[model samples]
Target: MEFVERYNGSGLLIEVEKILYEFKGVQHIQIFQTKSFGKMLVLDGKIQLTEKDESFYHEMLVHPAMLMHENPEKVLVIGGGDGGAVREVLKHDPKEVVMVEIDENVVKACKEYIGIDRGALEDPRVKVLFEDGLEFVKSCKDKFDVIIVDGTDPNPISQALISSEFYRDCAKICDYFVTQSQSPFAQPDYFKSIYKNARFKNKAVYLGFVPTYPHGLWSYLIASDRREIVLDLNVIKERFENRKIETVYYTPEVHISAFALPRWIVNLIS
Candidate 1:
């Protein structure tokens, strides 16, 4: 079988050996086995993560904000049903991580098949809540050092995650907020909407490469209540060294350079 992603006159097809799992619940979920990327998880026909290069997406999403914070003892992750973002956040030895996933079926599917989480779902420090992310953020009383929005693309149902109302609630509860902003190249409308709506005290859009994602590139928006969205390179390097965190794709240099967007992308934000 072949798994194909087609949109906007572009597509990616992967040769699949088997369909490991299929289900329809709050959202359609499918798992495919491919010799190249290992098992791939597709949620609502969009490639969420593949076993091989998921680090490129997850590490980029979780770490820059995690490291930018002086000490992220408490982290709140929204919509990371697969647990990949949670796994990366655990390396920081946070005191607690509150993971709010909307679909429990997605959580169960990834736990049994995807394996990207690597047991992050079962960590004692993690508290998994099955609820709508936007609603949860609005009702949450506890503050966090970092908040990671790991939701899906900017579709109609998921637009609330990237909305101004959501960012306002986030700003009240967290010092640093990071979110996947879709691919600036392949889905310019979605990315532009997110950047334009994010009216934080300070914000920056960082770059990363996710092969299976649209346009083979992805972007993330990091915002802070402080005047700075990112710390200095020297400070970042020093903090990263002190943490002694092991990562497959994230580095102090990468964290600093990711903010150096192309002129056009910068123009979109400005």
Candidate 2:
């Protein structure tokens, strides 16, 4: 059967070529393909990633804050079972990468089907933990230089991850952090709330395009306890050159532009 997903009353319909895998775990996980997007991961009828443009989302989510950090040796990732984010983090050659995901099935399924991970989960620097992300962050005592929250939308099941308490817990563990905030074009109110709740020493919102997602636009909220973790185009360019990192969609120029929000959205959040 041809698969179709309606974007939660957004009046957008996404059609799939076939259902590669569909099963119940914490949520309904579906893997499928489309002519435009290659392979895709869908959870609870929401599009997560497409192989064609996954790098844009993953790199935008992981890199800017990571480059800002003087030395992000140890990292924590919450809810990125697909390992795309970890794959990007590994490029920085961090000493350790710990990923806490509630669903082992998603990890296994992605490992088997999604080529985006490129065997990142098996890399020596990564440690995958099957546990609730909220509890994991609260209980973890060891600190990290960077923490990435690659969580889904703030539904009933995952709402706690977007709460002020959860941000507090994250702040306790990392000097710098980033999260996959929803599209400011699609869910500006929700995005504003998440940004306001994250009362860090330094905070900024950056965006990238995710063609398969609701609006083809994704925003990430980056926060740092360190005041010097500001975005400077020249510094970011230098960092990229020093690391010799190659990316498909992210560049220092793009990084600088992503923060230039529309005046109304800025006022709304302000």
Q: For residues 1-270, what per-residue lDDT tens digits would candidate 2 score against the true structure?
A: 344555546644556777789889788899997766788898887778888888989999998988887678999999998999999998888999999998898998998888678989999888999998889888998999999999887876678888888998898889898999897778877788799888887788877888766678788999877645576888888888888888999998988888888787678687
> RMSD in Å for candidate 2, one decimal?
1.5
> Which regions of candidate 1 deviate over 4 angstroms?
none
Off by over 4 Å in 2: none
Please give the clash total of every predicted structure, in order. Answer: 0, 0
Residue 187, candidate 1: alpha-carbon lDDT: 87
Q: Indicate which candidate wins on lDDT.
A: 1
Residue 100 in candidate 2, Cα distance off native in Å: 0.6
lDDT of 2: 0.85
The lDDT per prediction is: 0.90, 0.85
In model 1, what is the error at residue 211, expressed in angstroms? 0.8
| Candidate 2 TM-score versus the reference | 0.95
Please give the range of 10 consecutive residues that has the lowest summed lDDT in model 1: 224-233
RMSD of every prediction: 1.0, 1.5
In angstroms, the error of model 1 at 179 is: 0.2
